[model samples]
Target: MPSPPSRVVAVVVTFNRLDQLKVTVARLLDAARTEGLQRVVVIDNASTDGTAAWLDAQTAAQAADGPLVVHRRATNGGGAAGFETGMRLSAEWFDPDWMLVMDDDARPAPGAITAFHASDRTGAMAWAAAVYFPAGGICDMNRPTLNPFWHRGMVTRTLLGMLRGRGRDGFHLTQHDYDARAYRAVDSGSFVGLFVSRAAIETVGYPDGSLFIYGDDVLYSLAMRQAGGQILFDPAIRFEHDFTTMTDADQRFKPLWKTYYHYRNLLLVYRLASGPWFALVLPLMVAKWTLKVRFHSGERGQYLALLGRAIWHGLIRRTQVDHAQVLEWAEPK
Candidate 1:
């Protein structure tokens, strides 16, 4: 006798990227026929783009047992909140054994879901997919990494790399890493194509919505690891991220003020991963930020002020995801 299929629900969080969402949904639905993907819940974050209308039309056109379901949020709560909303609704209605989360622009290729389900993740809490850019380059941002602070060899190699001016590049996955045929253990992963078991959610709870964006996935993955849950990166299951533009060296004051959330949430992720060792790591992080601002940014004084504010708030561990506060800092004075 054969084993029964696992019940899986895909939870997609969309903001304003309707075009990408359409492509993602179509591919996911087509893949469902063979992948045991029973349901899909799309959480729309108040998209101004005709996203709501498109969803309504799609839902109406499908059968009563159609896999697609839509949740239209009144306010844009960002990706973290959107994922939380989608997951909660999925559990309530679909009651799936597993849930896969991704952004609107992250599209799983054909057979991606089937490949993921076939992988032997016996006790993993979550599994990350190898994310490549649409043009077939590795999506650097979604590469799963080992926590250097947790492993001695990783820490030593990471220190050497930083001394060689590689910074934290040692922690990120390389092309060779992404092309591996076997499953590899990882400390953290992004939401893009992340599949989480119901047991994992029950153990660690949902991703913190207060993060708004940036590093929420890292924090959640760390929490799962802390709870004795394993996270694996299975390269066989791959997704494409629609990131055509390159912005590697431009992570500073040019954005004027999104740096607040970036650095603040990063600190939160670092603190979560570091535990009692956060005090030891704090000075190094601060010094690095100071140097980056001094050498790279054009608006030195304003950038320093924003960095100081972010560090202070991160120290105090503020959890409020205030869009207004971020916008106030983002606007030019």
Candidate 2:
């Protein structure tokens, strides 16, 4: 008697990116059989750009017999909410052994899923793929990182990097690590190409959907680690992220509303990452973000105001701010 095949269900959270969603879905479906993918669930976040219709058509084409599963939301709930819904539904409906989560603009590279299924994934509760841009460069946003607060050397390097204005390069996986053939342990990683085991989900539960966007993945991954779940970064498993490149020199947030989520959720992430050192770490993090306001000269006043509010709300763990209010604040007065 042989062991059962590992069941994998992919969860993609999409909003208004119909073109990218189409490409991602097609790739997932094409490799489903070969990679032991049990199902592909697309959580449509009330996209108005014919995304709903397209998903309906795909479902019809499959006659509800294929591996495709569509969960259409009645409202635009951002990526965090979309992922929460997709993961819960996937576990309830398909009961897969693992749930692979990624954004609309991301998908596994050719043979990547096959490699994942073939790898010896023992002991790790979650695994992150080596995500790269379409041009083959590493996607900095998707890089896996160790928790600096958990390691003495990492904390020292992080402090030195911050003082030198180099950012936190100490905890992040190096280019050499990506090129290596061995897997590395990571404390946290982005949602793109992250595979979460059912056991981990059962222990830590779903991601914090209230986060609404930025930092949700980091928070969830850190929570997984805090719950004693090990996360591994396997370079052999690869993903392609078709997203716009934003350099560190350009620290301004477009649409402005995203700034609130970025800063607010960042506070929560820092608290989780630092634990007992949060009191000391919070001020340093705030100062770092404040220094970046110099780059937002076009909307410096509004940017600073938003940052203040974000900091206040984050301190109180408040997440009920309406999106409409955020949009109004972003509007030019």
TM-score of each: 0.93, 0.97
Q: Which portions of model 2 show Cα errors greater than 4 Å?
A: none
**Residue 98 local lDDT, model 1:** 83
- Tens-place lDDT per residue, model 2, 206-317, is 9988878889899999988988999999999999999763456687777678888899999998888999999999998899889878988778878888899899999999
Per-model C-alpha RMSD: 2.1, 1.3
State the lDDT at 311 in candidate 1.
90
> Taking the candidates one at a time, how many backbone clashes does each contain?
0, 0
* Deviating ranges (above 4 Å) for candidate 1: 244-246, 252-256, 294-302
Which predicted model would earn the best lDDT?
2
Computed on alpha carbons, the lDDT of every model, listed in order, comes to: 0.83, 0.89
Full-model lDDT, candidate 2: 0.89
**Candidate 1 RMSD computed on C-alpha atoms after optimal superposition onto the true structure:** 2.1
- For model 1, what is the error of residue 20's alpha carbon versus the real structure, in angstroms, after optimal superposition? 1.7
